[model samples]
Target: MIITNITSQKDPERVNIFIDNEFAFGLFYSTKEELGLKKGLEIDEETIDKIKVRDELQSAKSKAYHYLSFRQRTQKELEDYLFKKEFSEDTIENVIQSLSQAGYIEDLDFARIYVRDKTTFKKFGPYRIKNELLQKGVSKELIDLALEEEYHEEIQELVDLVKTKYSSIIQDKSEKRFRRIGGYLQRKGHSFETIRKVLDSIDGKDD
Candidate 1:
């Protein structure tokens, strides 16, 4: 096959070579190497082709792993991320499918764990947690399932947040303390009802 064109990849170390307008090979080199020609290039055609295939597969896998390392991402999120990084559609699809089948890119499970950690550990509320899961590309059905089972835990979390924030209110003697505490919890995604109940119980102690 004739190398018709060579294009520099976004990665400075790599290049894409086309044969008769078809993608035929990819190249990796350092900046010190000569342009338009390869150095230390002693590989046979058969070896070069095999190396290209292996590199492509390895590159896709590396991208998938690096994407997952920061935090859990849904399959769709990872796909979109890889696409933005200029991976081939087929490669991105295959990588995402493989990761999902391997149980590494599960949207439902990710949503559950994410919700649990943020609500129970981080003290975030349901609305905030739900919105965060949506941002992570989790489906509404999965979000609903996680939320249904986590309501009591999240409520208890809200109670804990109230307790932690109560000291801030103790400094103010007037209604200012109650309003400030309410707004604070509201921003944290707690509803008016829960905040009111918590505040009422606190107020009863003051009476």
Candidate 2:
């Protein structure tokens, strides 16, 4: 096969490679230089096959980087993202290995950070945090460790939240008010027992 032509793509940084006067593949401009590709260069069939694989790998890596730019992703999240984009399994695996080696995708770290954000900023309870982490593909053991580490102050956090949300009704002395407080706490991830204790204390039932 002959490399008959190479033209700039709309992206400018990429070029359309033509083989035997037909569009064969698109490659990054840097790829052209790295591969020493040029017009009228003769390439064997096997070389063409290798070039396609290389190009796909490069493309997959670029896409992964862009996907991870906004926020960290769980390993499964990155794999599913690349898979959904139609990258070959081998390509996705290689890209994942590279990203992991580069410290871009660490499930343990991602889990820890996620738990911190949800607890400190989102004010979510242990149940909700665990569910979210499980959905993100974190392992059960890691999720357990993360929740254990972050949930030590759960009781205080729930107390603070209910106090603020029902500040005007704090001393309303109504069963409905107690149920409302307990429901809000339960929805936020606190267990029913925890909610009951907090509500009981709020209503002076503990006295």
Across 1-207, the per-residue lDDT of candidate 1 in tens digits comes to 455666788987677766656776676643213333443234357755656555665677787898799988887788888888888787787788888888888887787788778776776667878887888788889998987876454444565666776776654658787788878777767788777776666656322
| Runs with alpha carbons beyond 4 Å of true place in candidate 1 | 1-55, 153-160, 166-168, 171-175, 205-207
- Candidate 2 per-residue lDDT over residues 5-82, each given as its tens digit: 999999977999999999988988888888999999999989888888888898999899999999999999999999
Question: Could you estimate the TM-score for every candidate?
Answer: 0.67, 0.89
How many residue pairs clash in model 1?
A: 0
Local distance difference test values of all predictions, in order: 0.71, 0.86
**Highest-lDDT candidate:** 2
lDDT of 2 at 143: 89
In model 1, what lDDT does residue 31 have?
23
Highest TM-score scorer: 2
Error of 1 at 75 (Å): 1.8
- Residue 75 lDDT, candidate 1, scale 0-100: 76
lDDT at residue 195 of model 2 (Cα atoms): 79
